[model samples]
Target: MNTAGIGGTDATGTSLRRLADALGTEMMWAGARDRPIGEVVIAEPGDVLADLPGALVLAVGARGADAITVVRSAAEAGAAAVAVRAAPGEDGALTPQVKAAAERAGIALMGIAASVRWDRAEADIRGVLERGAADGTSGHRGDLFSLAQTVATLTRGVVSIEDAAHRVLAYSDSGDEADELRRRSILGRTCPEPYLAHLRQWGVYRRARTGEEVVDVEELPEMGARRRMVIGINAAGRPLGTVWVQEGTRGLAGRTEEVMRGAARLAASQLVDHWFQGDPGARLPSRAGLAHGLLTGRFNSGALAAHLGIAPNASATVVAFDLREPESGDAVSQDARRAEAAEIISVHAASYRRSAMVAQACGQVYAMLPERAAAPSSEGLLTRWAEDLVSALRHHLRTPVQAVVAGTAPRLDDIPAVKLRGHHGLQVLARTPERQVATHTALTASLMVRDVLGLLDRHSEIRHPGLDVLARHDDAHGTEMCRSLLLYLDAFGDVGRVAKDLNVHPNTLRYRVRKAVALAGLDLDDPEHRIAAMLQLRLSREEPGTSPFPGG
Candidate 1:
């Protein structure tokens, strides 16, 4: 079988001299001098001419019949040229009849040395084709530059590397060879509006974000891109960017497609490195950087305090703000809103006349503020501040905002723990309807239950056997044994009060509680058993639409 074209052009179009040089043999070219050889085919006995079009037909061991007749038949069948094996120490010769037929039909006849193996000749030709495709101008020599240049050289086109946001990161310098849109993209640092619109219509960005490897685009004359190929770059399962190549005079070859795949991998590494290095001002420590460092355990309270200029005895509170965005907004619009909300919260925190460090992380805004001595209580001050901030933000953005204020951390070392508690409070508030603000001190039970639930979720095998039995009983039999027991414990086993809340007689409540303890194998007399059971019940009731204890 013939090898596929390597460069964007046909292998048959290669010069006869180039093919002979690759094979390291002397050849006499006769008849049809410059015609391209589309393929190399080994000749067989009967009527091989039918399969000979655009082929370099190889004739070996042809001493049986008239070789001139085979050459004339091949030329008639549109074979580009014929390569015949020469006898020992002699140049291969064609009769006048064969040369006349070749000259009439524009087919070149060549002779190969007898010592050269046929398989070696075919391998050499394939290598020549592959190398020709990879060779290009020396200007594209660096890592990214070479990639861009190699892509262009392979496809005979222009290339651009762009972030997910369509910001142009790099582009091949094709000089006058590039089209107007290509030049505009490089100069404006982004794809032009017309071209971007076309890409949007084609769902290019959507495909890129979803980790699609390559997207081929059809001709869009309005955008001046005839045919385009987009290769998405990704890192750690997230989209990094894309490499887009616009076709030049021809479509991309198989070799060019392979090169683009390699380029995408290289682009992913470059993008990850850029993210780690961050932007221009990233070297200087900033509030977000400090907060992130503390959250990830890269820094401690002492370093944070020294940077914020807080006193040793100062009281600090960690507050987190979770902004709600419109459900219909796209990712880009949602990001813009998040940035705006973060900026507003940071400005408000700075206005408190105390040392404040504000940061945004995990899709929420966090602020650590040192309380003034004159404040009535750290919780009271933070509550008032959070309420005011919420109202201002709601009025400005016309969206709901939730805020959580953690308990005061008296020592600098306690700030990280305080921040975690604030996050817990925020999560609890998220589940509660129409209740935006929460304080760590007030939601202690809910936070504790939430933490226990999280642990149980991750390590289900560690669940309390008694709680599991009771939960399964409630789920299967529609019984209120778990609810009654939880309320009984919450009311401190006050028979009268617990009965009133459960809407049952005191004796009846006691009997149900005894049944629950027996069925779940719980020793209610043990304080640890009571606490664990109470926490499990609370988690079950925390689900949406769950009814509270019947009365109080």
Candidate 2:
């Protein structure tokens, strides 16, 4: 097959020949092939491109004042793309000129800035050309049947998108390295730094905002054995993810790059299909395929739960989160920086056997903490657990992802209530930016408690004995006494204020409150009992309807 890329071979002579043939220019002075461009390219202003004979002479040097004259001379020579070398301090001003000139001349104005290593560039071009030739038969027919067969034949290993950072999307490898790579990236929750750095340099993430594909790969770190990687973006030019392949030193780098590009395009198509399907459930891998595989019954719950001690009576809370990345913005540098800020939640469920059950559900995990002596009163233990969990997740994931605690756990049956609380917590977090952590304490501590109590009042299952009796007695008497009593309690038992609020006499309001206390089977005289009765009444109020809780 036609595979065109520097597959671990000397391409300098060939690159120089290609450049010479394209421009029909003679080499002025051949510098040492091993010498860095900075040392060889900075002889003198006149000596630079002196013997070269071409209308355009691109001086690919590092960005500096020395390259200014070379760039101007190239433009004056009528070269469509007068690319200059980018130095540490140099700005790629030649790009604009190349674009303008290329537009006018109807030719490509590639910005071959010094940012690219010429040696790598030469190998890349050769590799691309060779692969193109191989893919092309006697005619312009691109035969991919063999390639397709090879891809499907994953006896050695299979490839798929695992994660994407910046424009460097990661691919699952087939060998030991690939397995280790996947384990480290997904299970370890480690940052793909090398990939991220490449994207940042190429401004691929930034360019995605404007709907542009990022095709730069010169800076990718050496993956020990020679590996070629290419990342593709979505239709919106945002990185859908990356594709990588390892084709030993047998001149497969170019072929791998071509394959990755094809994979990226395929991945993009899959993404669009996923969007149209509108099934959020389809976006994640099945838990059956995951490490613990709890969701798919690969792991038995009874034994697992028993082993983890996540029994029916264990107190646990459910939490949920919506993770998203910042939108790519204008300015390539800024965009790339922001694109790097994708949020992913890391759960420690992998570290525990039965706990993985929580990890597989709702994309959220659970922790069966040591039992506390008392259920929380204010910002209870459950709420504190949520806070601590969020803190630990942020630290482990190394990203600032937001999570809300849904509810606490007491047993398996509590899942429904916990899921509901999780949903409520998510809602509260969405509406309350300042309140990043959504614990039951935070919810109970808010004015929304009044609203929450009102909701509970409407639920047939939620029966506050003391509050229900008082309500029933008031209803039977055809008196607005319960409302008055609740108002009085809400106002801290202020009779004058309750009477004024009810537009009635203080004596009348006091009589109603006393009647409520007697009917509710509670003592109005005992402070502690009165407080408990008041809280029960508040919890029994009707609440506005939302979705049924998740687990329920």
Candidate 3:
């Protein structure tokens, strides 16, 4: 190995040979004298003691009978590492004794018989030094290499700054890409002034055209907050735009700052580059108007899909991300500010191999998958992809986000209609606080139960006027649990048994059965009464409570 990499320069071969002779070592060859010691060995002589350390090297001639003697000498010399270097192609002649002796000394012994010249040795020294520098970065040289590999993999398809926008750019090697990711998008349309101002005051404020601070704005808009997350558009610590962060979370604050700085640098560089090259993309249309148009087929899906390289018959899915209400300090209006939001949404969708489109009508964006024969049917896949998208957007946007899905479809033509249906699903989501999806499966399951109850009502002989009232009360109150209890009781008032099967306490179970009986105005022990209660619960589920059941 070239000792140059270990911090040594090439020394005169005659001098080295003289030193070797004085040290009672063989001269080996003429090449050994001129070989460069490009790296300095930091062993300090004490680290090179006779005991076995983590590393050992035993350099020797390729086919000499003294090879074993050289190995034994290195081990005895306290070399923790040993490498047996022989004349080219002499490795196969290495004996088991050499291996056993090295193993017994707890020293690593590698056999390499490649003929080395000054140039080869010098190159080896440089590689060794580079490896030493890498070790100094963290002692885990392997981990650093693995991290670099991962970063390469992650950034593999990253073709442009546009593709890098929403990704957590990190050097998976040195965590550099992580910093790069944070930096890449923080800088927004308005430059260092707005972001710098936001960072200075630590609250939301607007930056005037002249870069003057204006604090009169009630709260920072979502875009402002997002921009702040990306690139603290602050100048002299004064915010050019407003900034808001979750209070008391110092780690998040630091992360936010890192993200802002990285974003600012990337954004500024790109902005300058764009200025020189001339930007070609047009301003985006209003998402609300876009959505309304798409619903009405005013937006040409085929033309847009074709432009995006999507096949006509490919399957797709629509995802709707709903923004959270402005927190205590947010001043952005959803209708007027959506370009950044749309871009973020698009970036995230693209991460999942989904082509993104923000429709204007209901503030919903869809990532449609094209070119596939049949898209995924599971809402879980869509929901997971949506969550990941939202999270990535949040790092740059820092606004509250919620998402809903309309499940995947089998064809592109089905998206607009499916999207319209998805809008209705969004209404249901808005009416509730759940973040889980409301898809065709959930909707169909509820509908099927209702239809079954409708059939029972129509077929039942309960010919009583009060039947309608009983049905409505159960419709309002008797949910899946009540219906389940009625069925269980009908099996026989086997209280202890039903409780065990349902995983509930007996008394808790009895109360529910009694409650069901009272709600239905039926006697549990009576066959006709039990039948009526069952029919009532079933029928109530069918008639949406507002509808009048014909049988009743």
By lDDT, the best candidate is 1
Which stretches of candidate 1 lie above 4 Å from their native place?
1-315, 324-329, 371-377, 408-414, 452-472, 491-518, 521-529, 536-552
Q: What's the TM-score of each model vs. the native? A: 0.39, 0.29, 0.37
Provide the clashing-pair count of each candidate structure: 2, 34, 75
Regions of candidate 2 where Cα sits further than 4 Å from its true position? 1-299, 302-344, 347-484, 490-552
The TM-score measured for candidate 2 stands at 0.29
Give a tens-digit lDDT track for model 1, residues 1-552: 122211222443555556565655456567655555545555544534655556667664443244565676677776777766654443224545555656776778776656665544444554554443334311111234445654565456788887766766556656455666775555444677777887898898778666535788787766665677888887778887788887775556544455566567545645664445442122223546865675444687676766656665666777888886657648777776776676556545644533566666667777777764345255677788788778766765678888888776766567677777777677677666376688888888766656676776567566678777888998999989988888888888899988987789999998999999998888888998887787667666655554332221
Relative to the unseen true structure, what is the Cα RMSD of model 3?
Answer: 24.9
CA lDDT of every candidate: 0.64, 0.40, 0.42
lDDT of 3 by residue, 28-127 (tens): 3222322222222212212323432222233523234454554555557544344455343454234566666656654444443354532233224334
Ranking by lDDT: 1, 3, 2
lDDT of residue 548 for candidate 1: 32
lDDT of 2 by residue, 1-552 (tens): 001111112221223334333432212212111211100111223433432212223343424454455544443433222334433344544444433443454322334434465434433333333343343211110112122223322212333342333221223323333433333333222324665566577775555434323244342335322333334435564445443443332334223333343444434433443335432222222322332332233554455454443453445445554332244454565333222221112212212112323342343333323233255223354455445545544543444545655555554444555655655555555544444476654565542654555565577675548777777766687887666766776787788987997899898887887777777777777887766666565453423653222111
**2 or 3: which has the higher lDDT?**
3
Error of 2 at 247 (Å): 35
Error of 3 at 415 (Å): 0.7
